[model samples]
Target: MRLGGRRKSTNIQDMRGSGSRNRGGFGRPTRRVRLPSGGRTMRSSGGGIGGIVLLVILFFVLRSCGIDPLQILAGGGAGSGFEQMLPQSQRQNPTPRATPRTDAQTEFVSRVLAETEDVWNGIFQANGRQYPEPVLVLFSSQVRSACGFASAASGPFYCPGDKKLYIDLNFFDELEQRFNAGGDFAQAYVIAHEVGHHIQNVIGVLPRFNQMRQRMSQAESNAMSIRVELQADCFAGIWGYYTEQKGLLSRGDLEEALNAATQIGDDTIQRRTQGYVVPESFNHGTSAQRREWFARGFESGKLEACDTFNNDV
Candidate 1:
């Protein structure tokens, strides 16, 4: 993406590399709390009711991300069916302490997130809704969150309980070198996806899902989750749509996001990690599914068109 002249968002909290050392042998402090089955919900509180709306939109998106909700309910991470593959110890807890980053990466991520804010805020206002900017927490190793502690190994995520997006800048290197999803737009996609979750939270989709999860069976729950995730992917595309319309996207930028989305699809990640595919357990959808949903939003650029739950997406 060509964000050269775009204004950076000030709604960022740079905590990269600044993790607590004395707490664990790994020298990483968990940024979030691990309360097991009943962890606190992340909330968007830095702003007012208008901002809260934006935060809620993202929160609901995080809940399912198109994962099998039943699998998650059976011991999977509510919003992280894929991430749960990693051991609990590997996740970071955001208890700010020691940081190993050189500070440059922190600025880079902050700037990118800031740019997302600019684009999203503009979009919300154009649609007659107030855009509540979410905070981006940059950390290294581990960090604590309102939801619980998370490790860098757990990857980047948006905590609905706190309405803050957590990211380890180093993950960018991993996305490129390890996952083959490189480029600035790939990085931007990750942020956009999380912001997409923020959008869901603001619109009350998350709370409803959480309630539904309580009443649904495992298979049914998973299906619901898939719907949620696919929608987030669509939402990301919506952001891309606006970015392109605003002339912020350069050639190949959208491709970078598509590459990222494809690379991280449930099918791809499952194949690489488990050596097989379990369609029922598939969360985040297949590479094709992800690409399609994102494209839908990017092309349509209409929120009404992003209703993955009701549509054939």
Candidate 2:
């Protein structure tokens, strides 16, 4: 977590405060919905599976017309259901306004991204392959991606379609306040996890999973998703391992990441939100599972050891 004097990544797009406004409606009548603090009141196309599908179709139609679909879904709350359908992203919102503190947070994210680039580049070269670095898009309120339109509530995510990571930095605040997963390393874990997805995309794992999920039942697909997410957690742990080896990790850095993995586990989130845990519906693994997989990667630092698909998660 001690990133003092570290390099910041240049492959970052600062789209903060430049979000486009929602104008025309999709198909149905647009309704007004209140966003979190500093968020704009935008129009929604309605909620439900049918409504989301319709909005997606509309999104394509608008894209063909050279319009940004993010404008359409910004106020619609349609991104929630489609999160798992695509690659994983973080979702949470805090005040949208920029501040000096936010600048520091942005700097921290850039440095962490640089660290991942350094670690992964070396790993790929050692394996006789070149690493193609991914760009990270920093946005507030809403942003349009090749995967689809997303709101800040949709969280940080990596889109394989675009090979870029999208994040609303405010989610870091929510990570600390709502999930109780604070600290710089915890935030680094969040970025590293998404970068882990980028690794999956690079290694063809994500495409294979996407193809296989298409032929799976909902339950079966959810199971695959758990493996995919756990693998990403393991990849993040791999990054952590190298950081520790480089003497960059502080005393409690690993604990911060483990606590974060615990807090965001599907079981823990479901238990807190619904007062119960549904193992069948769990897609991101349990608290114990996440921590274990991360620990496994951190301990071994072997890509083979991080394989959650063939081995028991």
Candidate 3:
């Protein structure tokens, strides 16, 4: 990522270091369960019918609250993914909190966001649609979102309700240290992935999924979610396609991103957390699937090529 002279995006809102109590509790960071960090650090693999039943169960669980499970699951696993990525502790009572960030890292995130704005804006303009720039909320510990309260524990996510992407910069540290997926491009992939969710929301994919989930069986909904998440991965690759054409990617950047997609696959996360793999319970695709979809979008650079829903995985 040769972002030497790139400009920082002005859309970021810094809410670090501020804390307030809510009816549920005080603002606190999500409690991250410190999982051990030894693994292949390279690649891995994950399946089928019972998955649909699991999806239905999750939908009812989340719908009990105010969340539309399908919309939230549009990017990954049902509630569990949210729980693992963003802890329940922080969401209990979100308050404003900020931490000191290295100037270099913040600047790097801003540059990536700026590039996304330019690239997506261009794509939308070419299609005769206006691009709505999403604000990147940079917070530490905890922050509130339209989807609900969040903590860095949830990792980076886009809240469809609010149309904003929330990122805890510290997650990047974890990405580098634990996943061995370090690099500017890895970070960009995170941003682009979330922005990809925003794209889903803007195009009504998310809302439609929410509606369809109401009439679906658990397995059917989860299957739908797999497509949704894979599509977002493809969208991120599409963004990467444009960025690469703009000469921003350096030699190892794509490798870093590919490593990242594999590292965060549902199978890899499950194995890391529970010491076993459950294909039926899998939500996010396997590492190979993620890498393949992203590569498909990046190489083809055509929106029509990103039809993960139509392809049999």
Candidate 4:
């Protein structure tokens, strides 16, 4: 990706070292699918909302390019789910303790956010809607969000309650080191995926899903969450499409992003962590599902092509 002269987003809040550490661990139902507690549904692509590689072709492609995808997959840390716990009564309203600071990684994230802002802002305007840029909150190991408290272990997420993105820069380090899914585009995919969640919130998809999820059974909710998560992946792909159009992508950028998607797929994570599969418990789609949706968006670059709800995800 060509990020040399890109403008970084100013809508950032730096709160590193400003709060107590989160002794909190991953919530129940794994660390990947903690829905918001207050029914503030977050939704996009068509309905709602990775780390490494699973394909042989990807393995060869990456290897031929001098990047061993498997080596990155061997690292331990791997969780890509956002948290949505604690009732509204227990939620804390966090105040920023520091202003934006442009370190190397943060600047990369900020510029990616800016790019998304450019694409979505234009897309929204074209659709006769206004795009309200979301804030990206950078924290230490732990941080408080309107949705709930999160640890870097649980990965980055967007909270609909506050309309802001919460992330620990360390998570990106983990994405590459621990998850073996290193690359600028991979990191961008992670950010774009979270931004996709914000898009759902903006388009009223999440709000509607939140209301409906209250009555949904555990299995039903899980099924619905898969759609939501896949949609976000597609939305990220849409951003990728636009980014490529601007001549930002290099030779292996798309594969790197797809590699990250497969690395963090629900099935792959389960296989690595538990040595078994639980199809019924999957909230995020499988590895192939994730790669396909992202490619679909990248190929079509159309919002309508990302309708994960009405079609097979």
Best candidate, lDDT: 2
The candidate maximizing TM-score is: 2
Q: Which model is ahead, 1 or 3, in terms of TM-score? A: 3
Q: Compared to the true structure, candidate 4 yields what TM-score?
A: 0.75
Each prediction's whole-model lDDT (CA): 0.64, 0.68, 0.65, 0.66
The digit string of per-residue lDDT tens for model 2 on 117-174 reads: 8777767644445678877778888788877787777777788887778788888887
Please report the TM-score between candidate 1 and the true structure: 0.75
lDDT for each residue of candidate 3 in 87-187, tens digit (9 for 90 to 100):
24433223332433445676788789878777666666545466677777777777777767765666677777767787777777777776677888988
- Cα-based lDDT at residue 90, candidate 2: 39
| Model 3 quality (TM-score) | 0.76
The lDDT of model 3 is 0.65
What stretches of model 4 exceed 4 Å from their correct place?
A: 19-102
Off by over 4 Å in 2: 19-92
Candidate 4 yields a Cα-based lDDT of 0.66
Worst 10 residues of 2 by lDDT: 69-78
Tell me the TM-score of model 2: 0.77
What tens digits encode model 1's per-residue C-alpha lDDT throughout 1-313? Answer: 6666554555566554344222211222234321221221121112324543544464456445643232232122234223443335533333333343435455555567765665565555544566677777767777788768877777777777777777767777767865788898888788788887777766776656766577666666767677777777877887787677667788899899888878877788778766788887665678888889999888876666566664565
Backbone atom clashes (below 3 Å) for every candidate: 62, 6, 14, 12
Task: Determine the backbone clash count of candidate 4.
Answer: 12
